[model samples]
Structures are given as C-alpha cells and as structure tokens.
Target: MYVGQGGLIMTEVVGMVFIIIGIPFFLSGTIGLLRLPDIYTRLHALTKADNVGLGFVILGLAIQATSWLEVAKLFLIWFLVLVASATSCHLVADAALRRNIKPWTKE
Candidate 1:
C-alpha cells in the first residue's frame, strides 16, 4: 500500500524477495559461527558467509530506494563493509597464526 507510485508495489515485492533469500545465508552463517571448532573457521563463517547475507539484505533495501543516488550509496556502504570485514579477518587470522593458534582439522 504505497502512497505515490504504483510501481512501488513491484519494488516492494522484489525487495521482500531479496530479503527472504538473504535470511538463510544469515542463518547458516550464524550456525557455522557457533558450531565451528576454531577461530579461523568461525572467522570464515562470519566474514565470508555473513557478508554475503548482508549484501543480499542491502541489495534488497537498495531496490526499494527512491533514487539512483540512494542505490549507489547503499552499494557503496556494502562495499566498504566488505573491505573492512575482509581486512579485519585477515588481520585476526594473521595474529592467530603468529600466536601459534592451530587450525581445526577433522582428523
């Protein structure tokens, strides 16, 4: 029930679809973070998987944005978060490695 444009209905539907798709990625990331054996694996789950989840969420929101500028800004925010997450993950993994933290193995 949007106010201005009738097109808003389609936009809202698409946004909701994207958000629904993202939920499972977030769920799996959370499960992996909790169930994984070690810091490295947990970081992988949180950084890689969760970033994708957030990306989908962001994309969904972006699709509902009123203007091209808003869409660009949303994607820019996603990119910044992605870069920061990857950098932090690498730094943390490096620190763990330097401190002699071993990775988990199934064996």
Candidate 2:
C-alpha cells in the first residue's frame, strides 16, 4: 500500500537484491547436500549455508518492512531459526557419533 514514496521504492529494490543474492546460498547448500559423501558434511553444508541464506532473506524483508515492530519480529524469527538449526545439527552429529557412524573422508 505504501508504494508511492521514492524511499519505499529504493528500500524495496534493495530488499529484492538481498533476496536475489541469498538464493545462491540456498542453491549451493542444496548442491552440497546432494554431492557430499556423508551425513556430517551434508549437515554442515545445509545448516551453515541455509542459515546465512535465510538471514539475508530476513534482512531484506526487514529492510522493506513498514514498521519497526515488523522488522523486530522478522529479526527475532531469524535468530530463533539460527539457534534451532545449530542445535539440531549438533544433536544429529552427536547422535551419529554415539552410534559410531564414520565420517566420510578422502583417502
């Protein structure tokens, strides 16, 4: 609705650029997940890359947000997802270790 202002247009363009930049990170993460040889490495690729991608996307959305409250909420969601992904990755790796799953290595 706030589409008439020049500032709003600039912000929207910047936000779109951020989102476009983030897409490759997501693609690389997907590629790594498929190409990597083992669970640990796959998890590393997905969690780290995807987290950064999502962060950029969220940052872009926040930039275009109409209000401070919405911006804050977007950042909060990003932080929560960041923490959750790290925790879940750690748990999965730990479980794999406990079960004695070997990490794939180049010989």
Every candidate's CA RMSD: 1.6, 1.6
Residue 27 in candidate 2, Cα distance off native in Å: 1.1
Candidate 2: minimum summed lDDT over ten consecutive residues — where? 1-10
1-107 in candidate 2: lDDT tens per residue? Answer: 37798987999999999988899999999999999999999999989999999999998898888899999999999999999999999999999999999999899
lDDT for model 1, please.
0.92
Evaluated with TM-score, which candidate comes out highest? 2
Q: How many backbone clashes does candidate 2 have?
A: 0
Off by over 4 Å in 2: 1-4
Model 1 bad stretches (over 4 Å): 2-6
Please estimate how well model 2 matches the true structure, expressed as its whole-model Cα lDDT.
0.94
**What's the TM-score of each model vs. the native?**
0.90, 0.94
Cα lDDT, model 1, residue 59: 92
Worst 10 residues of 1 by lDDT: 1-10
